[model samples]
Every structure is written in structure tokens, then in C-alpha cells.
Target: MIVIIDNYDSFTFNIVQTLAAAPPGAPADWQQPDIRVFRNNKITVQEIADMAPDRLLISPGPCTPKEAGISVEAIQYFSGKIPILGVCLGHQSIGEAFGGKVIRAGRVMHGKTSPMHHDNRGVFFGLDNPFAGMRYHSLVVEEATLPDCFEATAHTDQAGWL
Candidate 1:
């Protein structure tokens, strides 16, 4: 099952709606696209894993990565054992979780549809061209911190890859 993890320190209507709108389809191809909110600053990754999600998708939240006190070590613990998708902090967590570094980008990228570069296998599967996607983050992955197992499937001047 694809579990869309609510990374928020708290739960909100948007997070609920995102999950309600898109529930997992099947065990083999299940994916939770909804934005579940942790709603509480005390929430932990182990608590998230308890939900029995086959894969994990980190969603945006009120807490910043640094303020949230998220440990890459915790995320690393859940690495290849399960499929993980990091959105804003989610993406950053994935990088940091797996020995990659994350830093604030020189500039901010906001809005829909931006130019991106793909290495080999893009983030969004089946799309061949530069993809149009949502953006709402201030940090970017450090090139030096990127892992060999990961590839830059999509990119923008502000943030690269999903």
C-alpha cells in the first residue's frame, strides 16, 4: 500500500481532504496522495510506520524541517525497506535521511509548471517531457549530498527533482 504520510505537526482540513479525495487503490498499487497532517510536533516516524504503509510519501506541514527536529537517521531507518516519496520537507528528508545534505536554495520557486531537467528515470513515471508540478518549498537538495541510488528525474532553477 502506498501511504501518504502526514508530516504536519497537526491535522487540518486540507490534509484530510487530500487523503479523502485519493485513497489507496490496491495493496499492489496502493498510494495515498492525500496530505495527512501529523498535527502534533511530537509525532514520530515510527508512529507513521505503524499505519502499515507499503510506501511512504512525506507531505508538507507547518513545521519546518529544522524546527521539526526530523532526523535523517530515522528516515534512513525506513529507506529501501519501503518506497518513500518526499514532497517539500519530505524530499529534503529523503536526501538528509540517506546521507544527502539539504540547504536553502538561493531563490524560491513558487506556482505551477516550471522547467526541469531529468537525469535518466524521472520522478514522475511515464512522463517523458519536462513535467508540470506543484511547488511550495524554500530548501533544495545539496548536489554533494545526493545519493547514487537517486537520480534527478525533474528539476527547476529553484529546486530540482521531486
Candidate 2:
């Protein structure tokens, strides 16, 4: 089962819809990908983990939860044991969770497709080399802060790191 952990209500719906609409044999076509959407908002990390199904997909949100009164630590602790796919916010959080740093970009960029530096191997399957993908984020990651487990799969001068 593949689980998508996020506070956004639409996160699961979007994933479910995309999988249903994917071409035959697409990665998301989950013959029965048990997709579980978790809302850790206003809840404890233990409670969130208890509800987790399997693979985790962390979605993007505010630059930092402090403004929203949310701590990434709790969620990170729970996701530590599970396979996780960090999206925009998810990516930043993953880095932050592992002693990485995140900061707001001087400018805001939102669109489909941006070049990325693939320092890690086999991160973007099917791609000949490192390239761009959809991006809708205002915060960027600090390379030095990222843990060794993560590779700068994609990046752009404007976005700093991805």
C-alpha cells in the first residue's frame, strides 16, 4: 500500500485521481495502491504514525510551520521508518527533518517544469539525465544543510536547490 501523508485534504484526492487517469502500467496506476491520506494537523506524531498506511508522500505547505504553529519534527520522526516521497513542502521538510535548512527564495516561481541537478543516481527513473519538472514552491533548500541520504536531484539558479 502507498500512503500519502499530508495535512491537505485534497492531497489524497489528487493522488487518487492521477493514478486512476494514468496510462496503463503507469507508476501510479496502483493495481490497488492503498493510498492513505493523513492529516497530522493539530495532532501528535504518534497519532499520525498510528494512522499511517505505508509509503509516504509529503506535500508542500507554508515555508515553515512556525507561523502556522506546526512542528516538522513530529511528522519527520514518524516518516523516518517509512519510504517517503517529498514534494515541494515535503522535500523541504525531509531536508529540515534530517538537520537540513530551508529558506524562502527572493522571488516566487510557479509553473510546470524546472531543471534539476541530479547528484543522486536513479532518482528520476526514465529520464536520460537530470532535468526539470513541475515546481510550485517559494522556499528553497540549503545544500549544506541537506543530509547525505538526499541528492540534489534538480536545481536552478533562480530556485537555488531542489
Q: Determine which window of 10 residues in candidate 1 has minimal summed lDDT.
A: 22-31
Misplaced by over 4 Å in model 2 are: 9-12, 19-29, 67-71, 115-132, 154-161
Candidate 1 lDDT, 1-162, residue by residue in tens = 444555553433454454344332323232444334443245576776786655555666654555444434446767778766666776677776666777777677656557654553313434445655566656777877776888555667655456
lDDT of 2 by residue, 1-162 (tens): 555556453454665666445344346534556665555465555665677555666665554643322336554675557666667677766777777777776676777476665554323544545566666767766777766776455566555656
Instruction: Say which candidate scores most in TM-score.
Output: 2
**TM-score, one value per model:** 0.65, 0.68
What overall lDDT goes with each candidate model?
0.57, 0.59
Evaluated at residue 25, the lDDT of candidate 2 is 39
